[model samples]
Target: MRILIAGAGIAGLTTALSLHAAGLDEIRLVDAAPEIRPLGAGINLLPNAVRELADLGLDAAVGAAAVPTTELVYFSRHGDVIWREPRGRAAGHRWPQLSVHRGHLQMVLLAAAEERLGRGCVRADARVTDFCRLPTGRVRVTLAHRTGDTSTTTEVDALIGADGIRSGVRRVLFPDEGPPVWQRQVVWRGITKIPPFADGRSMFVGGDSTWKVVAYPIAPLPDAAGLVDTNWAVSRTFVPGEVVDRAGWDRVVDPAKLLAALDGWVFDSLDVGALIAAAAPFEQAMVDRDPLPRWTFGPVTLVGDAAHAMCPMGSNGTTQAIIDARALASAVAVEPDISTAFVAYERDRRERMTLLQNCNRALGPEVVVAMADRARSVIRPGPSARDLDRELAEISRRYAELGGFDVAAANAASSYSVRRRPHSARPAQQPAGS
Candidate 1:
């Protein structure tokens, strides 16, 4: 069947690979951008997403480029280690949670898609204008060039909208759905070369007034270089009716502003102030969205940010989209009728998407405030240093109590394989030059 997919982001690329794995042919992907540019900063590939990448033969490439995060440390305003816990493989999960630059990850996926799907399978600068149902029971997509030269329409057996939050396909499907709901928070993210801290894993420091900071190492440099590609994001409550000016938004943030926000943050071992000061080319905020009612309509369906764009607090946005690709592809492979495939795909995904969105919303406020307060406390000097080992133990126990390691069961129950890889007759290769 011929398939037309909008957006060449993670969701769209993964969907193309998944459909190809399902033995479907004639897949075409389009994006509004004239050229695919590296946008966003970093993303965490949870165990579930790692498994999906493994299925597509991309685990080796992606894993090689990422830093394996073993622990998640939380801190209070006074740099006190409030809590810490094992993560990914360290937490007993079969797969590892990889922390990498979003741009690197996108390049990896784009290269793989181009290689496996052939050239011209994915097209940039092709913006979807509208869609019409053909008498032959097919869907025709009308597209326009970014240069405004000419418009063309192509017919396909089915269509999938992976076009991100401001998806045109979503508007075509659900005209009543207005703009994405604002979550009243602004966020700033940037990557910097800095020395690793706290076992070189990832850290989330929460403070008062709904301010939070999430930082993780993306790549390691050679020698005693002491340089690691780190990504950090700061978030706070935004005023109602605030408009984000794109040009002004992209302007570098004053280090003093960041320092003031994180003033009292006292996370144990590492100095939060030093870390924030070290980061450069700061990008400003415009965080998340409220939930959507539905993500599917007839032969066309939505995935990723297009369907359910939520706060990045839980690190579930990209992971869920990858899961959606797998689920939708599986549904299409099983259901002979195109409409039935779309229905089954939405049925399996909608509930999970809602759950994720709700989870993010619930956690957003507390986490944000905790981060802000922690930052302020560090500079103000208020509390006694908490015992590190005892605090970490308490956190680990709490995670265990909360069933943090039960991700396998959750993934299995969704009818999606946590890991999907074809068995090979030959054993895997050893270290290079072996």
Candidate 2:
């Protein structure tokens, strides 16, 4: 079936790969960005997604561009440990979880798409302005050019809106819904070349619900001073009625402000002040849309942030999108009717994503830390700490289970076997996005 995928970021690109592997290649990808460029900071590929990528034969490409995270640790605002868990292969998952620069991961997926789907099959400077069902039982998507007032339209058997939070396709479908809704939370994201924190492959989260910082190494450990690029983010809660303009906020912000918000967040390993001083931070309002009742609308459906944008609480955004692509492709591969595939895909994904959205809104497993922090003054040591630890660990395990990726189950599941791509084959294409 001919398909048009909106947005060439992770979700759109991964969808292309999944469809291609399923023996369908009449897929076209487009992004609003004039050209694909390395954008954003670090992203996590949970074992479930790692398995999906391995199935598509891009594990080596991703491995070369990213670091395999070994463990995750959480700390309270006072720097007390809340929870720690092994990740990926370390956690016994068949596939290792990867933390990589978002742009780098996109480029890796882009190269694979171009190599397998043909170069330029993924277009830049194209934006889907609107889409609708056609008389011929197909979907027609309209594109507004970036450089001109000109626009183009195409008809396909199906359309996948893998476009991100500010998705035009979503706007057309829900004009009344408006832009992404933001809570009273604002987050500042930045990366720095600094001394590696903790284990070179570890990721850490410190602080409570109202304020927090997530830091992780985006690349392999450095050779010398142990300096590597580390991605860091700090989020603060604001007044509920606070106003934040989405268009006005670029990824860049003053580092001093971020440093101020994290004034006391000095841990033994991660130096919050030093990292923030390394560079400016990109400011963003912590926002998400209320989960929709259905993502399937005839031959059109949504994926990734477009489908269900959530808080960064659990770091589940990209993983959920990858799984969405996997399920959609699997559905399409087995179902003869594109419409039926849309139903199956949504059926398999919507409820899970909805649960994820709720979990994130309530701060997922991390909420326990905030609760513990508030009760710390009255709560004594000993059993109190042990009980909180037990609760946090269960929350962590429950999130993985809720997301359909129980760590142990993921490790034990027999992975799909695909022929290894020859080492002598073409090297990874460094697109203009590079």
- Among these predicted structures, which one has the highest lDDT? 2
Q: Candidate 2: where is the Cα deviation over 4 Å?
A: 223-225, 239-248, 377-380, 412-434
1-434 in candidate 2: lDDT tens per residue?
67889999999999988877767768899888899998888988888888888788788888897899998887777777767888888887888889999998899999989999999898899999987765666677898886877899888777889999988888888889987777677788888899888888998887865787788999886858768999888877765666555552656867876666676676557877888887878887788998998787767889999999988876689888988888887777666566677788899889989999988887786776677677673135687777776777788889889876687667654333222222211111211110
Cα-lDDT of candidate 1: 0.70
- How does each model score on TM-score? 0.83, 0.91
* Top-TM-score candidate index: 2
